[model samples]
Target: MVGKTHFIGLMSGTSLDGVDAALVSFDTAGPLTGELVHTAYLPYPEPLREQLLAIHLPGHDELHRAALLANELSRLYSRAISELLARSAMSAETIEAIGCHGQTVRHRPDAGYTIQLANPSLLAELTGISVIADFRSRDIAAGGQGAPLVPAFHAAALRHPTQHRVIVNIGGISNLTDLPPSGKIIGFDCGPGNLLMDAWCQHHTGQLIDQAGAWGAAGTQLPDLFNQLVAHAFFSAPPPKSAGREEFNLGWLDSHLTGTESAQDVQATLRGLTTYGITHAIETHCPNAHEVYICGGGARNTALMDSLRAALPGKLLASTEMLGVDPDWLEAHAFAWLARQTRLGLPGNLTEVTGARHPCVLGAIYPA
Candidate 1:
C-alpha cells in the first residue's frame, strides 16, 4: 500500500434506491489496480426518494425544491462518508478526495444540458474532505454524451489482455463497455435496466423491486408487448447515447401498455426488454466479445440473469466479481478512481468511450 492513494466514491443511480459509498485505494504505479477496502449502501428515505423522483417533471417552485433536495443529498452523502470512514477505521485526512456522482434529475444531452443535483461545496463543508464532483458537464461541454463514464475505469481495472470482453452495468439504465483484445474501447447506454420494471413492480406488488425477478418469473412473456416496448427509438439510435427518467419512466411504459394484460406479465415483458436491449447492444457492437460481466443492482436479478445467459449463448456470462470487483460497488469504485485521476490532473473520460473530442480531465474540485 506504499504507492497507493485512498479515495472514496459516492454514487446514487437512476434507481433512486440509495447512495453507494466505496472506500478504495489505487496503486500509484502501474496497471491502475485498486482494492475495494470498504463499501456501504445507504438507502434514501421514502419521502426523499419520492421527492427526488417527483422533480423530473414540472413542479411548483422547482428551483427552491431542487436546492433543498441538493442540500438533503449532501447531508446524506456526508453521513455515508462518515460511516465509510468509521467502517474502514480511517479518517478524512487520510483520504485524497471524495468522488461524488450526484443524483441526476435531468439528462437531455441533445438539448445541450444535464443536471446532477448535489452541492459539492456543502458536501466539502460538511465532511471536511476535498470533493471532486460534476464529472459529466465537462464531457457534455466537449460535445460528448457525458454518460457511461465507467467504461474508462472498466478498461483500466477489468480489461483482459487476450480475451475480448464486455462489462454491462445494469443500473436504472443499462450501459455496456466493450473491450476488444486490440482496438479502441467502445461504450454507450443501451436503454432501461430496472427503472421500468422497478416502477411496475412497485405499482403492483408494493415492493421496491421484483426481488431477484421472482415476480417476473411467475408471469408469461407477451411477445407483442415485448416488441412494442423494444420499439422505443432510443434502442435503434447509434452509440454516444444516454437516457434517464425522462425517457424510460412509468409514463413511457404506460404509453405502451394496453391495460388488458396482467401486471406480472408486464413485469416479465419489462425484464425481457432489459435483457434484449443489453444483449442486442453487445452483439451488434461487440460480436467477438466472449466474456461478459454484469454489475449494479440488475446483476442480482436472477430472472434477468437467466434471460441474459439465454440471449448470449456460447459466451461466459457472470458478475464482475469474477474479475475482483464487487458488482454492486464497481461504479462507486470507478468514481473513486476518477477522483484519483482528477486529483493527479489526469484524464477521466475516454474520448473513444464518450465520443469526446479528446481525453480530458473531468470534474470540479471543492476544497475542504
Candidate 2:
C-alpha cells in the first residue's frame, strides 16, 4: 500500500449506451491522484440496450429478468476490462481491483434503496481480479440520495485552491459539484441530460444519438415547451437530490407535448431544457464560481455546450480535459478511485454533498 497501485473502473451510465472502462494508477502515501494508464469502451448491442431500458420500469418477471441481465452485464463488463488490460499490454493480476458502477435500472433514494445491477462475483471470476461494486447503497442507508457520488471524486481531482470551480457532469442525467475555495462541497442532480434527447432522437430519426446534436441544432427551441420541461419539480428542489429515468423519461416528455409540435422543435426544446438546467444550477448555487468544467457524454453535444456558454456569460466554460482528465472517461476513472478508497478503508462519500449522516466507505468487495 505504500507505492502506486493500479485499478480498473467501469461505468454504464443512464444513457444506457455501453460500458466505459478506465485503468488508472494511484499513489497510496499522498493526496489522491489518479493517473490514467488505459481506457476502453464497449457499446451494448441493440437487443441488450433494449432489455436494459425495459428493466428500468415495472414489468413482468422482472426479478428473473434482472438476474439474467446482471450476469450478462458482468460478462460485458469483464470484456471491457479485458480490452483495457489487453490494449495496455497488462494482465488481470496487475490490477488491484475493478470498480464497476453497474447498470442502474432503478435509483429511488427517497425510498431508501438504489439498485445497480451487477454480478461482482461473476465479474471477479471472469476477470481474475478483485471487484468492487454497489458503491451507493451505504450512503442511501445513511439517509442520502445515493446518486451523484462522483462529487467526492470531483473534489479530490478537480478542486482549485483559490478559485471557486464547478464541475458539471452531463450524462443521461446532469449533476454538478461546487468546489469552493473554502467551504463544504455541494453537489446534486441538476436534471435530465442526454436521456430524453437521445430517446426522442431515436424515436423520430432512427439514430441512437443526435450526433453532435446536429438535428437539434438545426431546429428552433419552443418557448412554451422549454418552460414546461424546465418547470419539473426536480429542477426547483433543493440540493442533496438526485434524479434518473424514473423522474425524466419519454413518458414524462410525452405528457408535456401536445402531439402537434414539430419533431425537430421538440428535439431543440429538449436540448434547451438540458442547457437551462445546468446553467440555472450554477447561477443559483455557484454564482461566484470562477470556472466551469463539463464532463460526461453530454459534453460531446456541441449544441448543448454552445447553449451553456451562451447562457452563462463571463464564466469560463470548458471540458474537464482542461484539468487533465478526459471528459468522456472521468466517471469511469472515479469508480477506480472509489475502489481504492474502499480497499484503503477510507471514507468515499462527502457528507455535506450527499446529505448522509456522515461520510462512509462505499462499495462491496468480491475477492478473486
Candidate 3:
C-alpha cells in the first residue's frame, strides 16, 4: 500500500493524562488496513491541566475561561503534531486530515448535548492540515449517547471470526465493546476507572497517578464502601450509556464516605469498584466472551489487572498489544479511523452501540 493517504489522529481522554498523536496509513486497494507508522505523546502542562479540571465544575466566568482553555489545547495539539511529524520525517503537506478528539469538558446526552473543548479551526490554521472534530454531536443530534465510539473500530480492527471478545478501555472512565462471534456489536461506559482513585491519590499523596496501583495494593478494600460505590444506578442501567467526571468525581466519593476510613483503604476500594464494574458488565452482558482485551491507562495498573484476572477465572485477559495494537494508542487510532470515515462520507456511528436512530457519518470538517 505504497503512497497510501496518511491521516493523523489526536486524542486527549477524560483522564487529563496527555495527548496522543498517531500517524496512520490506509490501503485504498482493498478493505481499510490501518498501519500505525508513528506515534507521540504530549503531557498537558500543570497550569493547563488545572484549568481544564476547574472548568469541568461550575465556576466564575466559565464561558470566558473555557474559551481560553480551548485555544490552549489547540496550541498543545499543534505541538503534538509537530513532534509526530518530526519523528516520522513526514511533512504536513503529505498528510490528509487530522482527527482530533478534543478534551471532553462536559458530556450530557440525556440533556441533549455533549461538549469537547478544542478549537479545531485554529488547529487547522496552526498545522495547515484539514481537521475533523466534533465527532459526537451528530450522533447526539440523532438521539444517541455519542460515546464509546471506539467499539465500531474494535470490531473492525480487533474482532475475530470465531471468538467472542470484549475490548475494555480504562481511562478516567471505563468503557467496553462486545464483539460476538456473529451478531451486532454492543458497548457502553462501565463507570469510573481512574477518575476516583487518581483524584484521591492527587489530593492525599500529591502524585499525578498511582504508579502500578502500588498505593492501593498496600491497603485493604472496605467491602461496605465497595458495595456502596457499585450501587450507583449507572452500573445497572442498560447499554447506550456513558459517564464522565460530572457523575463520578471526588465529590461523589466524598458523599459516600463516613469520615472514619483511611485514605489508603478508600483508594483500594476505588480500585475494587473499578474492577467490579468492568467485570460485572462482562459477566452480565457478554459471559461467552473468552478473551478480554484491555486498553487505555488502566492497562498498566498491575493491581487492577491482577484483580480482574482473579475475578474472571478461566478467561484470557491481555492488553491490545497482544493483538498487534498498542493499548496506549488504540483510542487515538480510532479517532483517525473516524476521521477517515468522515472524509469518505461513510457512516461512523453504530446505532446499536450508541442508540442513535441510525448510523450517521460523524464529525465536522475544519478545512485548512
Candidate 4:
C-alpha cells in the first residue's frame, strides 16, 4: 500500500487581501481523503494591495510592474510556507510539493488567456521545494473557462453517496459546485460575492471589508440598485462560464450608479446582490440539492449567511467546517490537493465544471 504524502497549498485569491497557506496530507493508495494539518496567513500591506488592485486594469509600464510584483508575491508565498512548516515542525524536504495559485490579475477565457502572477521558480528557490503554479491556462487552452477549479477537489472531498450536495465558495466572486448522487458534477461562477461590496465599502468608508456585513445589514436594500446590479448579462449567462475583476469591478459598479444613493443603502443592496446571486443559482441549477455548504470569506458575513438562510428555505445551510474543513481554509487546502494531483500526473480539473474539451492535468512544476 502507498503511504500518505504531504503538500503545501498557497492561495492569494481575487480579493487581493492576503495570502493563505495550508499543509495537507493525503492517502495516495485509495479513494481521496485529505487531512488538514497546518495553515498560515499574511495580509497584504496596503501599498502592495493597492498595486495589485491597480494592475488589474491597463496601466503604463504594466509588464515591468507585473513582473516585479510577481517576484514580490513569490517572496510573500515563501514566507507563508516557512510559517506553515515552522508551525507544523516539518522541513521543506518532508513535503512533496507546493501548490501556489498565484495572484490572478486577469481571467478572460473567452479571449483565450488567464494570467496569474507568480514567480514559481523564485518560490521553489526560496523554499527549497517543488512548486506547482499556473493551474488555469491549460484548461483555457482546451476551450474552457479555467475557473471555479475547486469543483474537482470538492467532489473528491465533499461529495456524498446518497445526498444531493452543493458547495458554494463565496470568495471575491462566488461560484457553485453541484454534487448529485448519480449524475455528472456541475459547477460554475455564479456572480458577485465580496468583490463589489468590499470595493464599495472601501471607497465610501476606507474599510477593507464589512465586518460580518454589519454595515449593510444596518441599512436597507435599494430595489432599483439591486435590480440594476443583477441585470448584468454575466449573471444570467449559461454555465461553463467564469468571472473576475475584469467582469465585475468598481468601474462596472460606478457605471451603474446615479451617484445619489446613500453609501450604506448601496452597501445593503450589494449584499443583497451577492445573496441573490448565490441563492438564485442554487434554485435554478441545483434544485435537488438540499444540503448546501459554504466556504471562503463571504461565509463569515453574518448578514449574508442570514440572508441566504432566509432565501433558501428548507435547505440545510452551513459552512464546510461541518465536513471537517474550515470555511476559510478550504480553498488553500484545495491547492495542496491540486499540487498532489499534478505531482502524481493526475487530472486536477473537471471538464464538466470548466467546460474544457477534456480533463487535463493542470499547472507547471518548478523543481526545488
The lDDT of each candidate is: 0.91, 0.92, 0.93, 0.92
Q: Residue 158 error for model 1, in Å? A: 0.8
Measured against the true structure, the TM-scores of the candidates, in listed sequence, are 0.98, 0.98, 0.98, 0.98
* Weakest ten-residue segment in model 1 by summed lDDT: 26-35
lDDT of 4 by residue, 173-255 (tens): 99999999878999999988999999989988899999999988888998888898899998788897898998888888889
Per-residue error for 167 in candidate 1, Å, reads: 0.5
- Write candidate 2's Cα lDDT for 37-148 as tens digits: 8999999999999999999989999999999999999999988888888899998888999999999999988889999999999999999999999999999999988868
lDDT (Cα, 0-100) at 354 in candidate 1: 81
Of candidates 3 and 2, the better by lDDT: 3
Residue 342 accuracy (lDDT) in model 2: 95
Which sections of candidate 1 miss by over 4 Å?
29-31
Sequence-dependent TM-score of model 3: 0.98
Kindly indicate the candidate among 1 and 3 with the higher lDDT.
3
Kindly list the per-residue Cα lDDT of model 1 for residues 105-158, writing each as its tens digit. Answer: 999888877899999999999999999999998998898889979999988888
Clashing pairs in 1: none
